[model samples]
Target: MKKTIIISLLSAAMMTSCFTTGDPRDGGIFWSPSKADARIGQLNQTNNEAMHQKQKAENRNKRLKAEKVRELNTY
Candidate 1:
């Protein structure tokens, strides 16, 4: 009986805590299209930047490999 009451109170507290706090930027209970679009744009920009970096690295690796092959052939 005592344990049950304690458990119930704990569960209620946990539930209330979950409800009361969080990033409001995530739209939470008040979402807008503008906010959503802004978030999407930020994500797209990040993805594009990452992809560009990756491509540059790949190109550099390819160039290095070609140089190595040419050096080996000349040796």
Candidate 2:
């Protein structure tokens, strides 16, 4: 009976240890950030790059229009 009780206690301890606190895989109640934060950051970076590209395109268009006007006036 004593050996059985000791074995039960050891098995319980092992199981509890395996389920460890603060482990996301075990579905613990820890409040940690998820992968959404990284995804949002990546999205923001992509947005900024797109905005910069758009601005560059607009500036190029303006320069080309100004050059065309100057050439027409000279001709």
Candidate 3:
């Protein structure tokens, strides 16, 4: 009797879960941007932009320094 009752309860639970899956909202997790996700994305964009700008400035400075040295050596 205990086994039969336990089996029936489990079957009923499984059936409910299966039926609920038919609903669109409950079927799967949509990858909508939450506030945290948006904030994280924004932070990532800002950091990447900053790094790019820093690298460009460093390259420009290096080129300028090299040109100055070349001019001095040629004089």
Best by the TM-score measure: 1
TM-score of each: 0.61, 0.56, 0.55
In TM-score terms, candidate 3 sits at: 0.55
Instruction: List candidate 3 segments past 4 Å from native.
Output: 1-33
Steric clash pairs (candidate 3): none
Q: Tens digit of lDDT per residue, candidate 1, span 12-75?
A: 8776655321335553554456766777788899999999999999999999999999999998
Worst 10 residues of 2 by lDDT: 17-26
| C-alpha lDDT of residue 29 in model 1 | 54
Q: Single out the weakest 10-residue window by summed lDDT for candidate 1.
A: 18-27
Best-to-worst ranking by lDDT = 1, 2, 3
Q: Residue 46's C-alpha lDDT in candidate 2?
A: 100
Query: Between candidates 1 and 2, which one is better according to TM-score?
Result: 1
The per-model lDDT (C-alpha) reads: 0.78, 0.75, 0.74
lDDT per residue (tens digit) for residues 1-75 in model 3? 999999999988776654322224445333334644666788799999999999999999999999999999999
- Worst lDDT run of 10 residues, candidate 3, spans 20-29
State candidate 1's TM-score.
Answer: 0.61
Q: Best lDDT goes to which candidate? A: 1
Regions of candidate 2 where Cα sits further than 4 Å from its true position? 1-32
Candidate 1 Cα outliers beyond 4 Å, as residue runs: 1-27
